[model samples]
Target: MIYSFRNSGFRDPETGVYNQTYFMEVFNREWHRHIRDHQSLALLYLCPHIHETVKQPHLLEFFMKQVQEAILRTTDLVARLNNNSFALGLFNIDEQGTQIVLHRIEEKIELFNLEYGKKYTSHVDYELAGYTCTPARNLRIELIFEDVESLTHELEMEKNKHIELRQMQ
Candidate 1:
């Protein structure tokens, strides 16, 4: 996250993490830097698939906490894209590294839910789009976010289709 010593307004008021505006600035800078330096960059879109029936106000905050904790490296960034959705930027990491970070966050959430039991419920699904295994493509940071969001939406559709098919069975 690009921290401006000039002002603290870049941070999300709720999660105390970088907001989308700050994230975009950092993403533009980082994308250029990565291109010049031949480094890897990845962005993960995390969405908490919370149903409307589960009205837990603190759920998003708690998940954001888990995300903030999981991304320990100063180079990594956590941003609140909106309510119940977050964006994590991983620099100097390829697809494998992104998966590792995702799993780490998942494990943390699982442990939290296990300990809290029925009183609290925490669940999330994520999608990742980043540099290819080969670093030859030039892409925009916004496209990465858009790609992941589209993939996540498609996955949700497939999952719902499966559920309907099973019901018919």
Candidate 2:
């Protein structure tokens, strides 16, 4: 929503949102703006359950729609990442605001699951990771992106540990 989707280069044709190339462009500009304005910026990286998505090809679209609806701010945006994952950016939002949006998304997703389970006898699952960049000196955009990506790995690890624990029990 940050830019006009009319330009094919700026948007992913299928998702009709910003593509990875455009995302980095905006992120770079936003990084400088964040430094100048000293405002809070939150980035969320989401990876839909690929296995489930294979069974339900529309699952990613449904999840992305929920995320888009949850983030109502004009300044907030969602972009397509590699491997069917996505990145959401919220500018001028603090940690609490970020948490609220996350909760909103989770609630919507839970509702979708409930309805889907009742009607289709299936459930959707996804992994989410978030990081907020506060006003700081000498912060690099590359590192922030890397940190969020690393968070994805950490979340997967935690999920696997839980699975292991459940198997043990």
Candidate 3:
């Protein structure tokens, strides 16, 4: 018998990585695995800043592609969740492990900035927030963060403050 495989084709056309639809499917599977196996998972949400310096929208896509290439691991799930937000699902990992991943991503961003030269202004600046959970915890993974909106607001404020400080220099 001949086998015919069907592809879901759920990837961001611009970044060539999983889109939100694929991400949600993978995330649900990982969540189920975490519940069944008593494993831990980390959800990192990243928001990229929009800047006037970017002349073309495709450039933003290229920048995100660079980010995806820099941060993704064989086991990690990365996806573009929205126009300016991306999400990463780290399975069977702890807080420290998540921190290490975040650190590496930040380092890659810095390296990308350096490589792009001093005169070019980058269109993206990432603000990251995360949540960690395990099966044994008394808390519900979905309810761990009750106020993502406020948290994201605070992060944006903090980022703006940093940008203002840099402008002063």
Score each candidate by Cα lDDT. 0.63, 0.72, 0.64
Candidate 3 error regions (>4 Å)? 1-8, 136-141, 144-150, 160-169
Model 1 Cα lDDT, one tens digit per residue, 1-169: 2346655778876567888999889877887778778877676666666567777666556767876787778988888888756777788777667667766776777766665556655445443223322222455455666666665566556643211000000
The TM-scores of all predictions, comma-separated, are: 0.75, 0.82, 0.77
Model 2 steric clash pairs: none
- How displaced is residue 125 in candidate 3, in Å? 1.8
Candidate 2 structure quality by residue, lDDT tens digits, 1-169: 2345367777776566678988888877887888888887888887766463346655666667777888888788899987658898888887778888888877877887787778676676677777887645676677767777777777777755211000000
Q: Who is ahead in lDDT, 1 or 3?
A: 3
Model 2 RMSD in Å is: 6.4
> What lDDT would candidate 3 get against the real structure?
0.64
Q: What shift in Å separates residue 17 of candidate 1 from its native position after superposition?
A: 1.8
- Which pairs of residues collide in candidate 3? none
Instruction: Rank candidates by lDDT, best first.
Output: 2, 3, 1
